[model samples]
Target: MKMLAATLSILLATSAAAAPGDADFAKGLLKKGVAFDTVKGRGKVPAYAAYLKTVLVDGGFAASDIAIEPVGETANLHLVWKGSGKKPPIAVAGHMDVVEADPKDWIRDPFTAVEEGGYVFGRGAGDNKFDVSMVIATLVALKAEGFKPGRDIHLFLSGDEETEGVTADLQAKQAKAAGVELLLNSDGGGGGLDDAGKPVGYSLSAAEKTYADYTLTVVDPGGHSSRPTATNAIAALAAATARVAAYRFPAQINEITRASLVAAAKETPGQLGDAMRAFVANPQDATAIAMLRTDPGSVGQIGTTCVPTMVSGGHAPNALPQKAALTVNCRIFPGVTVASVRGDLERAVADPAVKVAIGQEWVSTPASPLRPDVVAAVTKAVAAAHPGITPTPAMDAGASDSVYYRALGIPSYGVSGLFMKESDAFAHGLNERIPVSAIAPALVHWRALLTELAR
Candidate 1:
């Protein structure tokens, strides 16, 4: 999910090793959250925020310390757990809304959280609700235990991350005014297991590519289908989109991608792995670039990527198209301006008659400088799930609400507690889920991160 006025949005999983009672509580929270159907246009996010508020207030949080403010049809939930010492707040962030999933396309009702064969299946189960539930439950349990941190801890939940990011933009300014020192986003960054259940290094997303959507349009005078015309809007639109599809922005790299690529190279096998290493050593390696481009997983990490996602044309089949349009979404490399990406798209279209304009936009932020304390906290947390697993720094291809906070100068880290196999991830897709066994360890992970960092 990205469309920063230039690049922009998006987020999963768990297992056991800690308290089963608390794990069950988290699962309950998740099931209840899933039942709400907080998808955009549903107008249900406020109700969901109300439910979450109850979870906090019932678990010992004061009602005054929490607020549910409406943003459009959705709402944001902010909570504070005050600590004894004087320091800028340490925040934990995530989104309340999830992408739309049709009931007909899923085996189970996409909104119903179903626990099946050690997995919980639902739309937001893996993408975000899993981690969001864990964070909420952990804070509740910590409060009950009377564990006080060294500074105030805050929770910032955005109403719409899968579509527009307005909630996050507003929240970041509030966080800055409140003097937030750093943020731990539960939406991205986590450990992964191989097919054999062995650890594949944990990732701490330090940066993300910019996301934007551009609209390309062609317009012409309508005429009967029997009357052939050379300046047909539909034909011109098709050609323009085809050119955009064939276009490729130059390959690029930055601190986080460089580290992530090298780390990935060590784990990946064969020619792809070699290409990763070569590209890192020399970004201009054409052979390495070609090889990397062949794999979708490796491709976005190396450079900017754009694809035509949506299209529409004539009103009726019998009439020649009066207008035709396409929406091209792009994930731009860091340090690149939104205006620059728009310029590239305009050049690719290369048709002066074809209108090019912004369809959607969002903000972009640089890679957060690695902080030793954050690294240590995340490492210890990851170890709770997989002993000796050291998390590596990464730049996520998809943007998150964390980008908004980063734009404001607060260092934010994606330190999701869930450690899952890549094959198991299904955030914005059908029948999304996360393993049940991953829960207790995540509870442990959050507890470790909160206690260590807040202190």
Candidate 2:
């Protein structure tokens, strides 16, 4: 009887160890992430801060270990977990803020945690809340298993990343000062399905295009509407806009993007994969680019892109305006600088009648080299959990908080290990939500990554 009881106890422990709280814990954290959005402003700050407090408490972390550091205008919440060994810590970070979403547009309240059709629908569900929850879930599960990391693990969740990345920037500076060895920002861009619905994941963003806003001004002396003035301000602005629309920043391959394209090519299917292979094998071939350009995804890999976003230059229906302007937002390539993009715009609108000046510059530093240690850790973890999908090193065309750490010379990967299907809210679109099926696999991916990297 004694031996039988001991055997039963061991089996119970093993089952608990093997099975992490996939449902209750994830649901609880997802609810927390969604509810905290209410604390966006006014009383929102305290509300969000309180939510973090709840997360730390529920995750079995001591309140004393949770530190809130105020940087400039915003404060970053830090949760530190000490491991058994003495190695430097790896920082896993995510922003707490969610972009404004119209409640009317959503089928359910954007702030309310809605579990319907195997999805948790909300504003930050895919963009970052999902990642935030993943970290909490892993930590909670690890704590239950009495699993201590060999290295100190610091999880930093910033207050504001939606508007500007100021808080995230400050957090990176602070992390580096505190001696964080590896930084992972889980803010934007990740899982997408191929045309056949096969899950494809992008790991460690190698490079991101910098965002620069250019304002083009065309000025003409005001004249009566009946007189039909020549060379009107609106007309000049339109001509310049057309020129910019027609202009294309020449294609040039950078180190990281080239590596990413090669990896993606290996994974891509059908003729697209063939063209990708051909381009990587021979970049000089004009046909490679022309063929890749036929598909939208490949165009971003080889070029700097520009799109005219906003225009404001008209005065009145009856009067010819004296001044007109349009805003052109450009996402510059990795090797290309903001100055080079500006120069390209100037050459495109060379007519003396138009004047161009940079309005707002969001500069992104070049990507860091893929650290083999981190990559191998993530790759091993992913392969163990998902047999068929091979982890690939890639670059994101969209920007993320990862750029801030990369700027500080810290090895950063935009890794969440969460598989998200293609959806608009993945960035700034509506009805954004992560699927239920992805939740379990993501947990396994993150858990493996944490365990491997901690060692």
Candidate 3:
């Protein structure tokens, strides 16, 4: 009778270990509005943190293995699964914060995760929340399957990626102390789809442009509109702004970008493809450069870009402004110094009176060297999920938290398995969403990656 009781107990425990399906887990996370009001300083990150803690505990992780560090209104969740301790821990990170959205501009409430047609719509659904859900699901599934990793697996979730990324900075420090080997960021790269919604290829981001903002200010004596003169502050500011706008930074190619363009050209046919091929073979080809510039997607990949994003001149329409200012945001290419870019802008203005200053301080990280082991693992996982999909290494035009890790000598690669049609993605815009089909495949891919790398 005691033996029978033990057998029944084992069966019940096994049944309890099973986790929810991938689609269900993703839907639950989307409904939480984790990114809503994230920039307003009233982010829903705390609520999301509590929910994740519960999920981990239920998935059989010891409470001591999971740590939630709250930084101001934001938070970071770290989970550790100890293994043989023979190799450095493999870290996977994704951000919970997302850009703000307004309901008036959307077909549905931006915070409410809605399923329509074949897609799931909500803020952060595509930008990052999708990866968050996938990471959580992978952890839960691993625990339920009774798999033991050959090396420790660490999962880091940051709460301020869209803002200052304070949590990521803190996490990087901790990771370095823990002797982490490498980090695979789910928030950076993924598969690109063609116009027909067919998968073109997978991209692994090895580098990213630096994001910096500068302010151009012009000050002059106050005067009435009726007494306007050539020394008008607004006019001076406008002219300087125009000169800055007309300026174009020179085009330069790096190892990662060169490889990306080459791969992209193979997938794309016709004149555009020919141009891509020509530009790689001869960077000084004017015709090839002009042809590539016709496409907005290829423009940022080739050079540094700066554009006037915000402007403010007069305080009152009837009065000549005492001071005028405009903000020019630039994405500096790798190896370019911030000071050089600022100097270029000042020279373009050609106005001694117009003061140019860095509006915000930004860190520039060098490109990480491509790791053949990482490439092989990612390729294997991609093939397991999507047969015939080719994984290519590329650099991100925008920035991500990966820069923090890369700066600390830890090579970070963006290798997310999520695939979305380019036309269907609205990451930071209204009605942000991802296809329902994209979610399950990503879960499978992440699980495979974790198994391959950790084992």
Candidate 4:
């Protein structure tokens, strides 16, 4: 008995001493993730796929553990790590493709994977690579330690998330076919600590709005500019754009937003929490909504957003355009379908002369089904991870591939055990990064969440 107790004590001490090394491994993974981003793989899906392969290999992913399934123009890779059967498998998902960046705007080469002043600078650093590296390093360390998960773990890596969400959608479909119990995608924003350094509750995305694009076309009889009709196509488009911008849909208080507001109120002091509560109680209150709208992070909760992204319709300076078109992208709320948004547009424009047609761009699923299992599991797990931090069930304003699964009636949740200052973390911007301190603890949180859900 003494020998056994002595051996256990030594093992525990060794584990404690070795824990700090995990941070170093995390740094190594960050280096690899930044290196992966160095290749100009945006929109080059094949290159993105190649990059993922290199990352998986370099990150110590077993060959048999990761498999790439190609769908038309997307690649969905399923990474499986066998477990000890104590729990089922949970999926950790993220996209490898980053939005395009201009080299001139960056302080360093956006693709160079530069590590200076504690930041591993790169294009996809915050947008996703950070989470990806964190997961890889955690799992690799666990595997090396002979730590089999209580449940099977799957790491789903999708290419072309920046271009479209088809890859993740397809991958979710495949997982559903295999009876995947819990699907967790690390895409939605994480919990941010407030000014007082208190951790704000994490956001477990139960839903996300649908994304739709529509092109407004204006046509007139061709003629010289000098003899043009009173209404120019561009002029008409400008008017249409103005009307769309002016159009305001009624404010809504959905389950997710309500929860988000209440939780936020608790984390904040004085006016911030009061403001959040006021907004939650009556989103229709003009003053409350206006106040919340001032914060870009909270604006999406008030309602959906429509932005005019592209416009084209002109020939020569002297010749009046025969046709003109403007494309407007709308992020439709979950309860409202594309059809309803179209109907709303029809009413907003109230002009038979203007033709509004939905574009043929890739279709995305609505937010994942807000199933009871996922909500309960995530809420419990988050609470366990950050005591006193009340997580809010929320709908992601931006679309994630989980929307694809939700559309198919498969419940998917976006939960990452990491958070940072929105201003400092550059995702889809220059100098994207995650704090090195955030990595090790996040591993513990993720492992716990996965274990809980799998069981």
For all candidates in order, the CA lDDT equals 0.88, 0.75, 0.84, 0.70
Model 4: lowest-lDDT 10 consecutive positions: 36-45
Q: Candidate 3: lDDT over CA atoms?
A: 0.84
Q: Which residue segments of model 2 deviate by more than 4 Å?
A: 1-21, 42-45, 70-75, 83-86, 193-202, 225-231, 266-274, 423-427
- For 213-307, candidate 4 gives per-residue lDDT tens digits of 98888898869988868778888777888888788777777777777678767767765567788877777678777777667767667677777
On residues 131-189, what C-alpha lDDT tens digit does candidate 1 reach at each position?
Answer: 99999999999888888878989899999988888998888988998888899999999
Worst 10 residues of 1 by lDDT: 5-14
Which clashing pairs does model 4 show?
87-150, 87-151, 89-152
Model 2 TM-score (2 dp): 0.86
Give residue 56's lDDT in candidate 2 (0 to 100): 66
lDDT of 4: 0.70
Query: Model 3 over residues 139-172: C-alpha lDDT tens digits?
Result: 8878878989988888889999988888999998
Q: Give the Cα error of residue 52 in candidate 3, in Å.
A: 1.3
> What residue pairs are clashing in model 2?
39-44
Q: What TM-score against the true fold does each predicted structure earn?
A: 0.86, 0.86, 0.88, 0.80
Put down candidate 2 lDDT per residue, 109-193, tens digits, no spaces. Answer: 8888788887888877776778887777888888877887888898888877777668788878878887888887766435565
